[model samples]
Target: MMRVLAIGDIHGGLKALVQLLNKLEIKDGDTLIFMGDYVDGWSESAQVIQFLIELSEKINCIFIKGNHDVWCEEWLRDGSVDMTWYIHGGKETMESYSGFSKEDKQKHLAFFENLKMYHLDNKNRLFLHAGFTSMHGVEKEVFQTTLYFDRTLWEMALTMDKSIERDSELFPKRLTHYHEIYIGHTPTTNFGVEKPMNATNVWNVDTGAAFKGKLTAMDVETKSFWQSDNLPCLYPNEKGRNKD
Candidate 1:
């Protein structure tokens, strides 16, 4: 069977991504969904993007755009620099590409510029880099950017009031739109969760590869998961946004 595999934020941990992909033993026919943040935090941002581009040639790939990716596109394509991005790991991403040629850089720019904000499958499952405010579907252009930044959707799941009727207006539409929702912007480590977490049918797969933690990949059908070791261990000499 061609199982759907969803991966968390990579943050440019090429080694970790490789290790997790090995564990998944992914086949050419399988569909793979990556939750973005592919550049930044780690020291191999350029390598990570290169590997992903190659992998897309072998299997079906769905790439979601993260906030960090937005920062990357701005800097790489428009030569725009925002201090906010620099404060968050953009420096490392730039460093990773410092030696690449203009042609090499353009390839990566094309990849990021074409990333999707949200994706829905025939199974009625939704996948995005962050939260969404509308339940009607991704087509309801209600502050569409929320699909890449909103956290209230996950927060509500973590704090669901079971007393409220599901059919009532008081119920959050964000939680009822799809049969399942997968996201990756908010790190699971922030909530002390070290693995893929499912709350109110929303699955948070970002196990914090950007920080001093592991990278996660999950089978959306079987819920089976694979992970890499603490990424700091994977790259001893390079700092991966875990300066603290």
Candidate 2:
């Protein structure tokens, strides 16, 4: 049977990503939905994007856009750099592209440009880089930025009373929009968890590969997950995004 897997933020950790793919033993029939932040953290951001482009050709894949992806796309298109991005890993991402030709960069730019802001599978499962705010649903969201930057939705889910049923008026309206939600952006490691976390119906898969955590991929059906080695161990000489 085909399995759908959800991959978390990479933050340029190509080594870890490779290890995870090997661990998963990916097959042709499986679908991989990658939550974004594909670049900006490790020393291989450019290489990671290139690798992903190649991987997509061989396997079924869906890419979601993240805030960092937006920054990198801007730089790829116009050489514009966001100062915050530079501090948080953009410098390494730019350096990773040292010898790439204009055409090569253009291809990567197109990859980023084509990424989806969100994906809703036939099962009513929602996947996005971050959260959306519309009480009605993602379709009615007012600010596009909230789709990739909002944290309130996750925060509310985390704090919600588990006993509250979906039919309860006390339950959050945002949580009722989808059968289940899977997201990246806020690392579960931040909450002292090093694995994928599920609160209410929202699953947070970002295990903090950009920092002192592992890269993760969870099978959406079984919730069985696989993780790469700790990112710090994969790149001992690099600080990744944990630098001061």
Candidate 3:
């Protein structure tokens, strides 16, 4: 069977991420799928991206764009988006690369732009940065925006009525076409916490690593999971509280 590792939101916790990856004991053929939120929150965004770039050279790595990643792209393309991004822990990401040159920043921006919205593996599983709703079609989907910042879709999916057929053409049911979906963005309990829940075939793995909660990882094929100890939060008030 293929060994697939589904990791939760990193939120710039490079140290913890490295530790978790080490603990998993990744092998040559193993696939490492990062759910989203790779940067912002902790002070290692640059390091995290660099590490992923290096890892990409060795293994099959899938990086999906998270909301913060989208913000980063916006800030890079147009500086006007900095205010919103800064409020959402973008300051930390910026601070992480204080020493990098303009060229280095541009390189990272290109990497962010290249992130995928979703990954389909042999029709059995799907990996997305954030959950998708029926309102979104595959053709119109934008990885930087829809996959990362669409909270309206998330809420609709979360509060969906169970009595209705999940396969309906409206709401998040459109996602049912895929066997299983692994997503990040909405924290399970709160920031830094990890909870695994199954809605139809959708699986949420955000686990909130930015808010002093644990970073989570799951073996999709084996149904095994791993989590780090609670790490400290960068912005205690915002990251500590649950938005939902």
In order, candidate lDDTs are 0.88, 0.96, 0.74
Q: How far is candidate 1 from the true structure (C-alpha RMSD, Å)?
A: 1.5
Q: Looking at model 1, report the run of 10 residues with the lowest lDDT sum.
A: 132-141
lDDT of 2 by residue, 86-163 (tens): 999999999999999999999999999999999999999999999998889998998888999999988999999899
The digit string of per-residue lDDT tens for model 3 on 39-84 reads 8877787888888888898888988888888877777666656687
What tens digits encode model 1's per-residue C-alpha lDDT throughout 12-50? 899999999998898767999999799888889999999
Order of models, best lDDT first: 2, 1, 3
Candidate 1 stretches with Cα past 4 Å from truth are 162-170
* Per-residue lDDT value at 93 in model 1: 85
Better of 1 and 2 by lDDT: 2
Q: How far does residue 208 in candidate 3 sit from its true spot (Å)?
A: 0.9
Quick one: ranking by TM-score, best first? Answer: 2, 1, 3
Error of 2 at 9 (Å): 0.2
Per-residue error at 130 for model 2, in Å?
0.5
lDDT leader: 2
Which residue pairs overlap in candidate 2's backbone?
A: none
Query: What lDDT score goes with residue 197 in model 1?
Result: 91
Q: Report clash pairs, candidate 3.
A: 134-171, 192-208, 192-213, 192-214
Judge candidate 3 at residue 81 and give its lDDT.
60
